[model samples]
Target: MPTLYLLKTFSDSTFSLDVLIGEDDMTEHVDVVVAGGGPVGLMLAVELRLAGVAVTVLERRTDIDPTIKAGSLNSPTIQALYRRGMLPELEAARDENMRQFAAFAAQRSGGGGPAIPRFAGHFGGVMLDRDTIDQDDPVLVEQAHLGTLGLVSQQQFESMLERRARDLGVDVRRGVTLTGFHDTGDGVTVDTDSGTVTAGWLVGCDGGRSLVRKQAGFDFPGTAPEITAYQAMATLRGTEALEVGWHVTDTGVYAYGPHPGRILVAEFDGAPRDRTEPVTPAELQAAVRRVTGVDVGVDAITSATRFTDNARQATEYRKGRVLLAGDAAHVHSPFGGQGLNLGVGDAVNLGWKLAATVRGWAPDGLLDTYTAERHPVGEWVLDWTRAQIAIMRPDPHARAIRAVVADLASRGDGATYLATRISGVWQRYDLPGEHPLVGRSAPDLAFADGSRLADHLHDGRALLVDLRDDAGLRRSADGYADRLTVLTATADDTDLRALLVRPDGYVAWAATDAADTGPDKYLGLWLGAPVGD
Candidate 1:
């Protein structure tokens, strides 16, 4: 029998309990143990708890770090949050941030001038023209009300997620770090610094340097880093040395910012020798001068960090009882602001499916669909970042291609393409369906009561939209009531007779006429056989 250790701290004292592995009576159990209580982990925890699954999140940090990471939310991410009843809060937060930014910009411009343009988004350093996007496109039209872009700090976003997780009664344990874990053929015995937890599933949302991914032996393969980038908040002696906004210079690419002291510089001088080393003022000044070809002196610094274009992704998101999400599963350049949105998407997609599996009602191969649906998205993000890096290279060929891309980006179709990818609205899983909207994110269909389809999904259940209020369709869906919600609402689009939407807000089945395919097969395929079957 193996001896497992559990540590407990009482005030100033620490103690341990050594129990034999077979002694199940002494062990703590949970449905899932999520390592790393970042936004992704907390989001997953909330999703699990919403479905009544017992979840325990282990976070190394005692508190949320107020770091400026991802600064915007894409369209699909916005839609996902909206489905969870977070749209109002999201808008409030974005508005507050925008106000602060506006004040800052005003003060910088002497408090009296034409207002700066609101940021749409960017691909590489090329600015996307929002005015040029094709709003008539179905994809863009669906996302219009949701707003294709939302500006919010990652710290604020994580805080919101943490609050939601706690509200959902998720057992979030702070100051606990997952050191290692082993699959015991049934459940995962998670070893954290604080104690041991026996959970049916273990998920790693532990960022790029993930111990779970390495220890669980998940194969992560992709391109290596080519450039070392630095984002810092520091006082500069010569403020006029660099201009605000992104600049692709002969040496490398650099971006001064909307914020007074914020600066970001990227050099194609290979990866940093030691990314772990603390960035010093002297180092930052040198990099700034190198990239901008100007003598700028970094006097004082508040915070600084190094990043690379080192893109890598786990071929599989799961191995037995262990799984990975967010940066743990895939990492790439942060140029397009895709990381957070992608991770949030992963959490939403995996959440209900995992919850169903835990509750013992999931259809065959339900959990397997998580990777099948998400891995392609991750692959595309990796390639997307790589493409940006190609355009950012300082060589002559790269500059020529950059010009061409910039020109294309100025056009309606090109801008729409870029916006669609950046906003993540273009994401559509290849599900078994002929309808164009089948695998796409469901539109926010309106009802007679004025409540949108998103309002019906707040409880975290698959939805059966009965457009005709068909008594027969309602009767047919009665058997699967436990796993889904059947809403008898009038559709705004006359062509959409009825549709079955998954818990993640993707259309699973649709019908344009009475003769069209019914929801029975898709419901069975997704929600499993109805009760008493």
Candidate 2:
């Protein structure tokens, strides 16, 4: 066992502590060491810290990446943050980003047409008409108020998460990269460019090209890329006739400004020879011209990156003590902005379970459930992006399929289907329960005391929400009171009689009457049996 030494420091009225792994060994120790400081890693750090777990985040970049990525947060991610009491901050960030975009548009277009049309999202350049959506759809009605998407840049979201992580005393070390790690039977010994760290566990959130994932020897198998795509912000000439939204041309597809000089073009011509090569203005200009058949001149460019439809996922998320999350666990096309949302979901789902394991109260195979629940979701995302790529292919059969898909998406039912999937309100884990609400995200029900369900979940503990105030139900949950919060409140909107919510906000069990079976069985399955029982 590694010996831990404690050191305390106080500065700026904020408190933080440092743990050293003995002077003789000169190794640092933490409950968890997360590679990558992006939104996924930071969110996981915040979640773990809320459970009082010591976490250290290793990031190679000293500052947030400013490149344009994942422009919106889906429903699940927004609700996850809302449950953690960060909804207000997220909304503020969205509003600020909107304001900045409006200012940029005004300065660039000199107050022309609307910056961008209102829409839920798109599939293969086919827009999901927001106006055609069925507001009363069963899967979506409960979350209608939160809207389909939260418009915030990846940079803004990461900044917010980083701030929360710091405020919660997470050791976010920038300018440090994970060189390698070894998971001994007891714990993981992580080697970084800076130094070695002994941690209870290590998670790789280090994007698609994850060094941790590669070093851990996880098998990553999937399809090869068929198209090369380019996204850039540049100074351009012409484009007088280019449309503002997505367009599927004969050669490929291209989407012009919602932001000035910001464009994305995809060509069916095979993947780039070298994706690592920095995209030049002329290169992007040529691609744009080929896709749109417009003589657009790219004078200057900034923030350009190459991508493909390559999709791959780890056969297993965890191998011994080293695990993977976010892009490190799965890689797919970035269409429909699902990457960030998928990663955020992974963090929320894993944080509590991993924390439980580290704290020594996790039920048998509790940590194993992380991959079981999230791998399917990741697989779904990969297939979803692959479907989009299929529809966007520049072939006669693909165009025919695209037309049918577009028509379907133009109707109420199809729009609702796309909207639910895009917003992630349709996500449900396959937990063991027969009730309709079981294994689904707990509805944000409003209580008689003016508190919503999310308000009670801010502390990152399992919640036992009792609508009927049954004494038997209360007694049944008494054993796990230390790790559970019981809220007795009347909710008018939901027909649910009672709900046992996991720390990740998924319903573990539901009861229609006080006479029904007690929650002890399900609670034990998830939170483990009562100590000394």
Candidate 3:
């Protein structure tokens, strides 16, 4: 039997663990333990550290890969990254031609209209050329030319994130794979390849195959057997322009795009195929040639891996002292490039909440809101990606529907809707009540003080912008100065008081009404508190 070590915090928080070193045994205790050191995990660690929480990250991989897997970032994700001060570096390192555009192709469907669909507006997808439009983006043009999308490889992103985490006083240990975890009612004892460690709280930031989620006995409910996907990074010998093109042929569905000096091609199969069955360079070259009718020599092959698009979302993100974020919470197809973006968004959403929980200022139910808020978004992404994959299938019904949708997509409203869906701006968290602004992200509003609603969130604190006319309420709010910021604006003032903003930039409790709903109720709910509590 392994010797069990018990650790206690100053606040009476205690953790117990059985330490084991192969056949021998030793144990150590910690405050919070995070599994995985990928981008999502590292981002969570950094966010927690910034919030003054102590965390330790365990990573199995020794290095990151240089090849870009996720090709582009949407505007909402750009804003989230900007909040973390990572936008500058990412923008600087992204491929230059990162402007969004739609592509239209014509094909004949047996049912009707043009066989090829016409797509317009931003729904078409952004072209990240990595050569031209990189410097013009306002966020990240100044950092050393890393690679478009900010850092060149997964390893480099991890390296930079590790440096940032260290700057914020986080303990990151690499080459440590989690083997097993035990929840001893008080805390969790995590058994890793390196050693056994105990912590008051544990977060699973590991990828789709999350060991932490499994250890917690949380069920990932959804479709199983996993849909497979094939991805490869290959250099196109004679292409300088980077553009994403969609080609629909009777034989199959194929898409190609310029990536750095190479081009990436994706083929969807109705059935699973062995990823390591051995693929020749000539085979890939031939596929590209078949799709584009352009013979671009394959100078080099970076990586070819097979992955599944498992549409499974963890039944719950939080289970006792352990929590899950990013891919650990949800897994879906890579259609519309939603996986990485959604994962990063999850990190941003959970980061502040975790920090508040650690700091002891968080309300009782605030932490639980992570699952309440993100689970639906994850489910939505999975459904949408599945639809996208279905669209690429060679079935007659799918083909006909694609044709109809493509034709409908040519219109302004259809194009706008598609753009919103692809850009991820259409997502909104569920808020109670029938208020017009509730559940919708508050639009940026200009104020007389030269401040924007988003600007107030820089300190990572909840904000209460009083748009009501009662001067006495503002005076009374001064009593709770430390917990909330009171900004006064006249009802007639179109500039500042036009909207009441929530911390996450959503209009949680907003009104143009001069009538007082009582600041306490509004503020309490936005602060994740129940009325009169």
Candidate 4:
């Protein structure tokens, strides 16, 4: 086994580590080492720390990326932030972003138009209605009944998560790049530009071209790019006659947005751009002309980026003590801003399970469930992006299909289904249970005392919520009381008398008041044995 270094000072607080006593062999040791300090990495760090495990984040970049890659956070992500007690700051950021977007919309509409409600998340340029999507919105969210989505820039989101991780006492090392690593069966020895560190587990949240994934020999396989997409903010040399929204034409599909100079284009030329080359004004002008057939001159290219329908995913999320998350685990098009949501979901799913393993109370096969649960979700997202790209092709047949989808999305049922899918509320894990909500994300139920179910999850721990004073249920769950919090309350809204909510905010077991088993069986399945059993 590779030798681990002695304990090092982690934050300005009392802490301890079971590190191998060595000085020159290793510089530091932690419970977990998270690579790439994006929102996914920072979120994982927070989750591990919330479970009382020591974690360190090794971020290559010293500061946040400037590009506004992901425009907003979807329903599942917002609900997760709420569960972590991080909604207030992000909600304020969302409100500010909406104000800016509304102002831009007014300018485009020439003023006096109705203000846009802050929750219309679009998929393939189709606006998902907030009213239909979030009818059963997560309770206690800042958006309330409007929706569970939040409009915050990727930069803002990552910055906020970094701050929260620091507050949770995570040691974040900036400007440190991981050069290599060795998973020595028991722990991981990670080599970085600064020095060598040892940890019980290592997770790579690095971007799509993940060095960790490459070095660890994880097989990433998927379809090639069928279309090249571009989004640019440049000075357009034209008047305000351009109508905003997708314009499907005989040649290709192009779109104009609320911002005056912001535009996007898609070409079915089957030619992918060299991603290494930065997008230029000439290239942007050429792409726009090819798709819209409009020779709109570009005076300057302020910000520009290119993506493709290239989708790929790792065969497995974990290999021994080394694992992957976020872009390192999967890569897909930014068709509907699903990349960030998918990556954050991966972190949330892996965080608690990994912590359980590191803390030494893990149920057998608990770690394997991460792959079993998230791999299918990742595949679903890949297919989602493929469908969008297929419908956006410039051919006559594609336009006909697009029209049909547009009609369906305009209807109530179709809108609800699509919105639910896009928001990730449709994604319920295959947990063991017969209850309708057994495998689904738990709805934030409100109690008669004005307390909400989401309020109890602030500490990132599992909750066994008993709607009534049931000592039998409490006794059954008391064995694992150290890791589970049993909250007894009254809910007048639903008939659900009991729910076993996991740390990641998913329902493991749910039952109506009439069920005789109470919350007994699923407790051991998820939280392991009771304390004194």
Candidate 5:
């Protein structure tokens, strides 16, 4: 017997349990085997354990990637981190960047004028301001982080999530690769770089070219590359003539930097360069010259990488017992830095459903919703990227359309819509409910004591909040015990008498008229087997 640990701390508490690992005809077995121990895979592991399932995460690299491939984390992602209690330290480090942006916005707007996107985001090359966005006050972040589009290097963000996942006792195996997997229908036998392990499910959190997706024969079809995009960080001098924002040149589109040390160069080269090979300093310098028509001096190139709008997606998120998440399921242009945010969103949405399936309480077709919900969202993101690429084309039609959008983006409503879409604020599911908040992210409703709704969901269980403290509703929740948590609070607002919230902080049900329609209806629909089953 091996002592398997559960995520006891940072949630309810950290603890370990005894379980059989090696059994007859096998090396070890877990309820879930996750390939590619990046942000998404690790997040899924934590979600599974929160539901009391054993999970093992296998990653290809021995260490975190040094490349800062992603540079932005959006609002939804910030909320996810806050839910997991991993936001404070990262927020602490983000102070300087926030201050810099704040100062820049003040200077640009003559010191606090009309609202903008709080942080600078872009569509194509056009800037989208957060202050201009028409949204409720942010519910997911602290007061200091409100309305501010904050930036954290990919390295810092991934390291934090990885640490948080490990603290939850997830078995994250590094330097391990998944060579193959067989979905025997009942379960999956996965062969990895280390050895073979069997599990009830297998998920590939690997990158775009996913072995699991390839071996499982998931159909991935989409547009090819429009252009090769290059991002570089280097030591440079004597290039002040280079513009600080996106530029559509006669030749191609290029952006110099908000950071004086960095530069972005895009060439309308039909095919993207081979990213497998390391980007050379000479290559980066040459790219700079080609885009800017400037023989800029480069002291040294710290990092260089290339990407394309070669978007593709899996026709299905899962095949039999094999599933996919993150880049394995979809790949897109890195425009607006949605790649990481989208992958993290996938992990959060799929986590609880998959865990329920493994724990044997998943209602019929519960796991299937993973694809149903994410695939469309993935499609939307791909089109969003494609739309950006459309306007960046160096042609009369593209230039004219770009001009019209730029003008429209200045309108309050237009900017708000763009900001909301870019921040993923409008993302809502069509669940079985009529309540307006049912399919949307639950408002961080404040209690009379100032404690917000998320305070009760750290345990990753469904929450039944009774503002009126009605005995019937209270008893209704008590039936589910650990699966359903009941909270008694005088609401910070009096709009609703009570509500039910899922672990992901979405409202499952709510009652505004003080009528207790029996919490069992919604509870069973979501958590299975109602109370006192």
Candidate 6:
């Protein structure tokens, strides 16, 4: 057996941890250790700190990347950040004219009949122009701004998050990578580039190629796509029309819009290139000209990358003491820009749960629910992206089918359904039965105390909104006072009287009528017990 060693820190803050290691041959133990320091990892660290959990983040990169890979933030993700008081900074950086365009696509059917063009009406998608909009939106906006999504370069966003995590007292270490890990019964022994650290739980928030996931012996199951996408940012000269045109042709699909210095243009359905081959500026310029029907001069090339629309998800998100989030858990095509948003949501969901478990305020089963809940969501995302990718195929029959679907989508019901799905406004949990509170995100309602439902969740505590006549519910929860908040309101309050909220802002229990049940029975279940008969 390896010898055990303990590294003690002087700090006694709730977010601080004592590191354990195998000295020379010593083995040690700790509560939780996270791998990767990207946005997902940093967000998880900040969130854990906020929840009073001790966490350490290990990052391989010495510095943050300056390129803006993922640009759009979705509505649900914005709401999640708002609940934590982190949305304003992001909203302030949004573009003013960055709005979604709704349109219908019509294509003639290949059959030897009259042009059977199908029309799909407006589907909501955002035009993310970050640099131009950063000034007006600033990083701090009001709660009302939470209703919309914002845009920021990946590098800039990560920088801000790093600062925030440090400010929140999260122990972030760079130039450290997870080499391997061993799951001991009591905790996990993690081997890093610097040294070994032990923790009660290990979370993998690393990217698609996660060492932690691999080390944990988890399997990622999914299909790889045939066509690959090539993307690059460049300073190119384009006519006013060409600069604004979102073009598609027989060769490939291309889009051009104003970026910081030049036009940001991208091409999908391009042939794959080997990683060893250098993608030159001339090659990208030629491809752009071929697809756009415009000869644009490439002044400078910023960055270029190639990725396939492979849709795959981990078979499981959790393996014993090790959990996965972000790209570590799932990876799909970037068609909907859902990658980063989904990962951030995972961080938000798991962060509080991990914190609660570490603090002993939550049962172990609550930790298990993270994978059960998020894995299905990942599967759904992969399916959605696959459907989008299939439509992009250039085959005549596929185009004919797409035209019909587009036409149907243009109609009232089809349009509404497509719009809601694309806008990501229609996602709901699959609750077991028809309970009013089931499957719905807890709404941010106004309270008599001048606080909103989101205000209670901001501190990472489950809130029991009491509408009944009893004031005794508050007295009963006195023992769990620090972990629970009881809000009393009359039926006239309408909004606040209708729902009980979980820390993640989900409806734990709700009633259409204010007098449905006293706070005692509801509180018991919301606090992890079934209501007594």
Residue 42, candidate 1: Cα error in Å is 0.9
lDDT of each: 0.85, 0.87, 0.62, 0.81, 0.77, 0.65
Report each candidate's C-alpha RMSD, comma-separated, in the order given. 4.7, 3.4, 8.1, 3.8, 5.1, 8.0
Please report the candidate that would top lDDT against the real structure.
Answer: 2
Clashes of 4: 3
After superposing candidate 4 on the true structure, give the runs of residues whose Cα lies further than 4 Å from its correct spot.
1-26, 111-119, 127-149
Task: Please provide, for model 5 over 430-504, each residue's C-alpha lDDT reduced to its tens digit, 9 standing for 90 to 100.
Answer: 788877778777777778887777777777888898888789889777557857788888975457888898877
Tens digit of per-residue lDDT, candidate 6, span 410-472:
454555455445445455665433355565666666656666667667777777776664455
> What's the CA error at residue 270 for candidate 2, in Å?
1.9
Index of the highest-TM-score prediction: 2
TM-scores, one per candidate? 0.93, 0.94, 0.76, 0.91, 0.89, 0.82
Q: Give the TM-score of candidate 2.
A: 0.94
**CA error at residue 525 for candidate 6, angstroms:** 5.4
Tens digit of per-residue lDDT, candidate 4, span 125-161: 6666666553543422423542434678788899899
Clashing pairs in 2: none
Candidate 2 differs from the real structure by a C-alpha RMSD in angstroms, to one decimal, of 3.4
91-179, model 3: which lDDT tens digit per residue?
54453333321111111122232322222222112212223222343223322222334223344455667788877667788777889
Candidate 1: residue 466 Cα off by (Å):
0.6
Clashing pairs for model 4 are 479-530, 479-531, 480-530
Model 6 Cα displacement at 277 (Å)?
A: 6.6
